[model samples]
Target: MVLSDLGRRINAAVSDLSRAPNLDEKAFDSMIKEICAALLSADVNVKLVGNLRKSIREQVKFKDLPPNTNNNTKRRLIQQAVFDHLTHLVDPHAEPYKPKKGKSNVIMFVGLQGAGKTTTCTKLARYYQTRGFKACLVCADTFRAGAYDQLKQNATKAKIPYYGSLTETDPAVVAAAGVARFRKEKFEIIIVDTSGRHQQEADLFAEMVQVQTAIKPDQTIMVLDGTIGQAVESQSTAFKQTADFGAIIITKTDGGAAGGGAISAVAATHTPIIFLGTGEHMMDLERFEPKAFISRLLGYGDMSGLIDHIQSITRDSAAMKETQKHLAEGIFTLRDMKEQITNIMKMGPLSKVAGMIPGLGGMMGGMSDADGTEKLKRMIYIYDSMTAKELESDGKILVEQPTRMTRIAHGSGTSVREVEELLTQHKVMAGIAKNMGQNKQNMQRAQKMMQGPNSKQQAAAMQKRLQSMGGAGRGMPGMGGDLSQMMQMMGQGGGGMPNMAQMQQMMSQMGGGGLGGLGNMFGGGGGGGRGRGR
Candidate 1:
């Protein structure tokens, strides 16, 4: 079974417990059996599975509990026991290697051929670059033809500097030279890509040892193939003998039946799983957390990760401050709208963002990055047609003079109706800006409210306030239509969808309160919070 299948089965078992009118010995045993079956099917070790079952039984054993403990408490303990046991299945509880900020932290990549080691080297550099590190890539894989070319192409595209030799045939020499060059250049993080073989050839292990001795890398990461199933254990063990692996990255985890096996292999080695390769893109690598990973696997969205995504895009305090100044000035310029959309796009695919919401995924569901990117392009094209004065004035020409809208549509090669629609969107946001600028205090208060314990409820109330302030996104094209469709979907599926929390949390991250009206689009986020909807 794949990671997703494991989640599905476990979720079904939990649902069975939640629905049962009575909690009995048979019911508890049935849940345990289901858990064991899921674990075994995922290629987890039979011994580990037996231990998990035994641990759960011991955890819920009633004879050790106080007589006053109720059945509900007993049931909750059983669920907690299962969660705790599952968490330990793959988490080695070892600290991952961390790169020092000011120092040159060298990372060496080692894995079997075709395990995606080269790709991961570039991805790792990009990850560090996004977080403000001066990261560079070095290609030491002389065994793999075109390794330098591949690294060069990725480095050039990311605008990150790189070092490699087209003529170098010795992996150790290449690695040593690259590390020396990057360290002299004052690069903060230097990543070295080493050679690999189809099989664990003696030469392969010897080459790794030679490279390891030469560079003495701060950390050596093993890029494991998640599709290899239970065999990952043996591969990880073999690599462990070659060198000290500080961490492991499981690649091709987007969907692979043996991903569980690959994960469980963490128990076989000293290294912890640090990242998971979810897609082909460099941005697809996610920092792995056992609890959060298990949560998403069970179809529960990852909110903390979503918040981190927003923070990554909005980390520039100065940019957010400028936006706040514009919002406070109550000028919802066309350029401001473009910047908001641009920031959102930079956070990644809209479909993925929608998934962060519990049920709103259906509304913006199945929207690929291509589709979202195209929509962004069209909107920007319209902005490109607008004059500097027009953009700054928030499309006043389109609002006051109908002919200006016509001219823009002809210039943009879009329908006059489309231009009008875009202008209408600006107006909706502008109204929110006006309200927020007028009542910025309440919005700021709401921003702090987010850190409170009942953030979900506070966010919901904030949404209602935004709706009341600006007619709740009524005028935008399909605004009302989408809301009705969403309401219908929620009705069809029992109404506990948690859409409000998802919508509000995201909108609040967008810039707080003035954009709360736009949160109407997602049905949350307007909770008296304000973002830099300048």
Candidate 2:
């Protein structure tokens, strides 16, 4: 089974347990057996399969339950046990060395030729650069003819500092020169990309060793191709034995059916996986969080991961802040709508974003099939069809004038109904943004510590501030008056946004898909989007 299918199978196994009328040994054992099969089929090691299965069964059998032990509690225990074991199987519990700013920290990359070593190096550099670290790249792969050119192109595009030479044939010479140059230039994180032979050639290995010894890098990361599956174990071991690799990165996971196998294989080697390359884009790299990965894998959303990805995009902190301020007062313009859509696009595909959420992870593939992206593309064109004045103020002109909507549809080659749908969607998003802004501001105030005479005084002061802030809390966006209510709504599945089906119906009644994604992306968090370059 593919990794995606494996997750469904595992989830189905658990879901079956949850639906059982009685938590009898027969049913529980059946669930365990099904899960074991799914994991083993996904290229997870046999030993891990056996261990997790035994552990889950033992926990259930040995549990200290009262005479009236309920099925819900029993099911939860089994689920938790399974979640914990899977996490343990992945995390090596080893902390890799992190580069501190203002000092040169060299990191070396080693892997087979097709493991995407060069691109991974660029992604790593981009990751650090966006996070305020001065990072540069060095191409030391003299074995490959285009290695230097590829690195140069990637670095130039990302605007990251790079050092390499066309005439340098020896990788060690290039490595030494690149390291010295970047260090002199005060680059904090310097990454050196080494060559990877097709079949682990002895000469290439010796060259890698030579480069490593010459550079004396702070960390040596082994890049493993997830498509190779069980072979990753031997490859990981070889790299570790060669250079004492500090971490591992699994690439091509976006296309690799054996991604799970590679992860499990690396775990068996006791090497910590630092990241997963989820797609072809430079920003497709994601930091590996065991709980988040497992949560998403088992059909639970990784809300934290989703939030972080949203934050990474959405440039212009001041503009975002201004937008939020205006939105809090229930003000949203067509231009603001454009900005939000652009930010979402920058964050990548909608399905990828959906997979990061807790409830939507399981339906990622289906969501992709829902033609939501085509709808989004239409929305973007509709946005592009708007005039400057139409975008600046409220969309009152477009709403008041049907001719304008018709003009937009004609211009964008879309139906007039789509334009109206986009408008109505904007209204819903504005409402949510307003609530989110107010709620976030109120919450920040509540979380503050006041210098007061007593606890009662502070409590009264907080209440007064909340009251002053208009604690109406009805349809409040983001984290507001009742977190439980928001979670309850989320559990009902619209991802705390207005139900998509209902939104579509509303759109059909008047004519909206652009703003539906906005609520889930920013409505809950109301991030300041501070500490980033605007």
TM-score of 2: 0.83
Q: Write the per-residue lDDT of candidate 2 for residues 284-339, one digit (tens) a residue.
A: 88888776677777766565676667666543366666676677676778878877
User: TM-score of every model?
Assistant: 0.71, 0.83
Model 2, position 527, has a per-residue lDDT of 19
Query: Which regions of candidate 1 deviate over 4 angstroms?
Result: 62-79, 311-338, 346-351, 355-534
5-97 per-residue lDDT for model 1 (tens digits):
777788789668866787777888999899889888888878888988898888788677887877767666766676667777767889998
Error of 2 at 85 (Å): 1.5
For model 1, state the Cα shift of residue 55 in Å.
2.5
lDDT of 1 at 437: 70
| Each candidate: RMSD | 9.1, 7.6
- Candidate number achieving the greatest lDDT relative to the actual structure: 2
* Top candidate by TM-score: 2
